[model samples]
Target: MASNVVVDQDSCISCGLCVNNLPNVFRFDDSGKAECFDPSGATEEMIQSDAIDICPVACIHWQ
Candidate 1:
């Protein structure tokens, strides 16, 4: 299955956990919220899973 990671901006707290965990794939926006920096690049599947795992609101999803 193809895989990708996304963060729900509405639910995101911009804690930077995802940024820290997946720096190459994630970046902080002007508002400090995590944004997809490389949606089409190679991503660590486990790290995406971890992002979903660590999200306080459970808003992260794999697509």
Candidate 2:
């Protein structure tokens, strides 16, 4: 099953970890918060471990 990742803007701390590592899937929005611009940009596995797992603010989640 393919999973879509989402970033909780309210919980985001703008750490840049997700954006810096998984730029294809995540990016900094106009508000400078991390957002999932393209859920299909990266593999679900990579998104889970690299973005969700490493999220300092626990803002990234599987949708």
Candidate 3:
């Protein structure tokens, strides 16, 4: 199954943990908030789970 990793902009604290952990999947905007480069485009399971695990607010989810 293809899983999408999503980050809630409102819940994000700009900790940058997700970006730092999964650069291929996550990025930061001008406001310093992390955003997904391509949700549901993960080619590896480990990267998807890494983003979910490092999200400080646990806002990142896959479905």
Candidate 3 lDDT tens digits, 1-63: 666666788889988877777777889888778888776445656665677766778877765
Q: Please provide, for model 2 over 9-52, each residue's C-alpha lDDT reduced to its tens digit, 9 standing for 90 to 100.
A: 99999989999988898889999898898989988888889989
Q: Could you tell me every candidate's TM-score relative to the true structure?
A: 0.74, 0.92, 0.72
RMSD of each: 2.1, 0.9, 2.2
- Winner by TM-score: 2
**For each predicted model, how many residue pairs clash, with residues at least 3 apart or on different chains?**
0, 0, 0
The candidates, ranked best first by TM-score, are 2, 1, 3
In model 1, how large is the Cα lDDT of residue 51? 71
Model 1, span 1-63: residue lDDT tens: 556778789889888777787777778888878877676554566555757688778777776
Q: Model 3: how far is 13 from its true place, Å?
A: 0.8
- How well does candidate 3 match the true structure in TM-score terms? 0.72
The candidate that wins on lDDT is 2
